[model samples]
Target chain A: MKELQDRIRIDGQVIGTQTLKVDSFLNHQIDPAFIMRMGETLADKFTQDGVTKILTVESSGIAVAMAAGLKLGVPVVFAKKKPAVTQDSETYLADVFSFTRKEAVQISVAAKFLVKDDVILIIDDFLAHGEALNGMVSIVRQSGAKLAGAGIVIEKRFQEGGKKLRAAGIRIETLAAIEYMEPGTIRFAQN
Target chain B: MKELQDRIRIDGQVIGTQTLKVDSFLNHQIDPAFIMRMGETLADKFTQDGVTKILTVESSGIAVAMAAGLKLGVPVVFAKKKPAVTQDSETYLADVFSFTRKEAVQISVAAKFLVKDDVILIIDDFLAHGEALNGMVSIVRQSGAKLAGAGIVIEKRFQEGGKKLRAAGIRIETLAAIEYMEPGTIRFAQN
Candidate 1:
């Protein structure tokens, strides 16, 4: 966690007051050692919860999810943004209105993947409005899976997503929480 | 490689004539141990090449890329499909026409992450038409990077991608190459 916070502070570029671009390492260009370390941190945080599956959204979250999944020794199920060409089955769909994309897209997971009696932990790269997390939680509920908790690499605390999830009685763990980000300045929340 | 071939035979499902769905453990829902093994195998195959970087596309490729990156002790840089709001700098963009989606989607990678001197080994979940790999190769060429080769988890030999790349003198190593697949029947390439 300390390493993550330090790397974020040193490398994360805060853009336009809210968007933190970590493409240099976190999401796009990845530091696999750091990713592995991050996974160990997540495992240390959530492995005791008896989590059965690690769920995340498509694209950026896959790397982080895989890292955490590797450390936790669990299967990772990433919600697909694009529907599978062969998929035409009745599925659990959740519409996540992306604050960044400025549109709502339906993220789905096959019914067979998520089933009842499964404990799921959701992980992602960034948490802003929490729409994606909300979508994953909705899918978990629809599948009758237990919500173990959520782990995020970075959380925009200025945004309401992390707060809302915590308020909703969901246990949340974020490696680095951005307390403030403005022009030429950034602040991190003390653990 | 035997384990991967065995896993594919057991878990992979042929959706259509072209697509083999290994959703249970390869792409959608990932088995951590298996992914690690696959990565280790890829690393073993490419260890002599002096690979400084592991490259792949976003979404599904991130997991396998991370795994291979971990084994090789290098960073993984994924070409993003549709740059995020934070991404606006000059990038090497390619239009990948997907027969499954019937659309040519643009995928791009930042210019800074990949340098002229870097030796890159591209990794991906599957290879069918090789559009994605081709695009990555193009990106590498544009950046003046040395392309070590590509490491694919599964390659559809019936498709022209593998043949085309190998014909183009690119080193390609696939864990499992499906030479034939019929309804309830599958055949793997003899190594």
Candidate 2:
């Protein structure tokens, strides 16, 4: 976790007072070794939770989720994002609004993947407004699966997402929690 | 490779005569350990090529690319797909048409990720018509990077993509090459 924070401090670019661009390593251009390390750190937190599946959204979350799934020895299911809703009885659908893209996308997982006996662990690249995280949780609930908790690579602590989700009794573990960010500075929340 | 063929024969769902749905293990839901094995096999073929980076498109391609990147000890860069073209000078873009979805997507890689000195190995989940693979090849050429070749998990040998790319002097290594497929049967091309 300390290494992640240090890496973020070195490579992360803070935009205005809100956005942090980590595309250099985390999302777009990925450092595979570092991502595996981050995944191990996250999987270490939920090792005892009997997680049967690791859930994440498409695109950005796939790499981290794959790494974590490898470490956890579980199948990783990525919810596919569709621009428009498609009626399907064999899938579980959840609507997520992206604050960055300013678009509403429907994320769906096939019904056969998640079941009541499965324990799900949700993982994502970032937790800002928790829109994507909440959407994944909704799908898990729809499947009647037990929630083990959520693992995040980076969490914006200044935002209300972490607070609101934590208050809802959903256990969340973040490798790097940014307390605040300014145009060239970032502060991490103390563990 | 035999194990991959076996797995495909067992789990792959053949839709009509052309489509092989491998969402159970390769795309929608991923078996992490199996994917890592597939990546190792792919990377093994290019171990002598001095691959500096692994490239793939987002969503379905990210997991396999991550696994391959870890094995090759290189960075993995996933080209982001945009429904519509955006004006960005810092990116290299290529238009890809999806035969399955019947849509045109612009896949872009950041200019900073691929350089002339970098040797790229493109990895992907499937190679039907090679639209995505061609898009990646275009981006790699745009950056003036040397391409080692492509590693495809499954290649439709009956399709023209593999033959066309190979005819263009590109080396392709496929774990499972399907010669043909019917509703409930699949035949792998002899290695």
Candidate 3:
């Protein structure tokens, strides 16, 4: 977690008051081994809860979900941002509003991938408003799968998403939490 | 390779003359270890080529690209199918016609991710029409990067894409090449 926090402090960019862009190593351009360590840290927290599958949204979250999936020896199911040509119509669907993209998009996972007997751990790159995490949680609940918890690489503590999910009785673990960010200085939550 | 071939034969859905859907383990619902094996197989093929980066298109290709990046200890950069809010304007772009989706979509890589000094190895899940691979190759060429080769998980030999790329002198290694697929049977090209 220290390495991740250090990496974020050194290389992360703050676009505005809330945007903590860690794309240098976390998303856009991926450092596989370092991200894998981040995933392992998440797995260390949630692997004991009888998680059968790891879930996340497409594009960015795939890498983190993949690292956790690989480490936990579980299958990773990423909800598609849009329906594919080959995607079946019978799917558990949820609508998620993207602050960055500035629109609502439907995300889905095949019904067969999530079943009643499995326990699911949802992971993602960032949790500012928590719309993506909630969308995934909605899909997981629809499948009758147990929501083990939510894991995040970076959580913007100033946002209400993380606080809301935690208040809902869901166990959420974030590798790094950003308390505030200014032009040149960024502050993190105490361990 | 045999395991991959076996997975396709057993779980892959034949949607027509050429649409082999291996979403059960390759794309939608991913088997991490299995896909990692496929990536390792590609790393085996390109490890000696001095690849500085592993490249692919976004969505599904991220998993295979992630595996190869982890194995090769290099950064993996996936071209975005569409521009994101965080995406840079200066990019290397190419248009790709998707046979499955029945449309041409523009894909791009950030200018910083691909540079003249880098050595790139492109990898993907399927090589049916090779349009996606072609688009990626164009981006790498635009960057003036040295293209080591291309690695594919499954190549539809019946399609002309693989043939065309190979004839043009691009080094391509496919884990399993499907020669033909009927309603209930599928055959792979013998090494």
Candidate 4:
């Protein structure tokens, strides 16, 4: 966690009060060693929870979730951004608002992947509005799988997404939580 | 490779003709261990190439690319399928045709992550028409990065992608190459 917070401090770029561009190492361009460390740490936190599956939304979250899945020896299910897998009967659909895209996108997982027997751990790269986590949670609920918790690489605390999920009784873990971001300054929450 | 071939034989679902539904383990729901094995195998295949970076398309490709990055102790830069990262001065863009979506999509990578000194190893989940890989190769060429080659999880040999890329002198390593796929059977290329 200290390493993540430190790396974020040096590499995180805050833009327009809401956007944190970490593409240099975290999401777009990945530091596999660092990302896997984050994942292993997340896996360490939930090792005893009997989490049977790791879930995330595409494009970015796949790396982290898959890393966590590697550490846990479990499988990862990433919700599709394009919803192409739905042509067959192998999907569980949930609508998520893509704040960046300015549209609601339907993210889905195969229905067979998340059954009543699964204990799902939802993971992602950022937690701004909590739209993506809730979408994973929605799919888990629909599948009758147990919600284990959520792990995030970075959480923008000012956005209220992290707080709202915590208020909903969802256990959440974030490697780096940003407390404040102005035109030039960025703050990380003290653990 | 044996493990991968075995897993595919049991888990892979063949659709009408071209679509091999591997979401159960390869893409939608992923076996991190298996994928990382494929990644390690890919890493082994390219250990002599001096690959400085792992390149992939967003969504499904990020996981395997990250796995290869982990094994090689390098970084992965995924091309964005949605073109969201181009809002700044950080991207080199390329156009790709999404055969599944039946649309032309623009994929971009942050310019800072790729440079002329970089030797890129492209990785992906499937190779059917090679549209995605060609898009990535275009980005690599545009960035002036030397392409080391490509690593594919599964290659449909019946399709022209693998043959075309190999013919173009791109070094390709596929975990399993399917020779043919009919309604009731799937034959793998005999290595």
Per-residue CA lDDT of model 2 for A36-114, tens digit only, reads 9998889999999999999999988888998899999999999999631222358999999888788989899999899
- State the lDDT at A62 in candidate 3: 88
Interface alpha-carbon RMSD, every candidate: 1.0, 2.4, 0.9, 1.5
Q: lDDT at A26 for candidate 2?
A: 90
Residue A47 of model 1, lDDT score: 68
Estimate, for each residue in A31-78, the C-alpha lDDT of model 1 and write its tens digit: 988887777787679868998999998888887788888888889999
What ranges in model 3 sit over 4 Å off?
A: none
List residue ranges in candidate 4 displaced over 4 A.
Answer: none
Candidate 2: regions farther than 4 A off? A83-88, B83-88
Candidate 1 pairs with clashing backbones = none
Residues A1-191, model 3: lDDT tens digits = 89988998898888878777776787778998998898889988986799999999988898898889988999999898889777787899999998878899999899999999999999899998989999999999999999999999999888879999889888899998888887688888985
Candidate 3 local lDDT, residue A5: 80
Clashing pairs in 4: B90-B111
Where model 1 places Cα greater than 4 Å from the true spot, the runs are none
lDDT of 2 by residue, B1-191 (tens): 99889888888878788878787898889999999999989999999999999999987888888889999999999899863122235889999998878889988988988999999999999999989999999999999999999999999988879999899999999998999889878888886
In order of appearance, the predictions have TM-scores of 0.97, 0.97, 0.97, 0.96
* Candidate number with the higher TM-score (3 or 4): 3
Poorest 10 consecutive residues of model 4 chain A by lDDT? A81-90
Predicted candidate 3 versus true structure: per-residue lDDT over B1-191, tens digit per residue: 88888888889998777788887888888998998898988988998999999998888888888899999999999888888677777889999998878899999888988899999999998898889998988999999999999999989989879888888778999999989987788988996
Model 4 scores a C-alpha lDDT of: 0.86
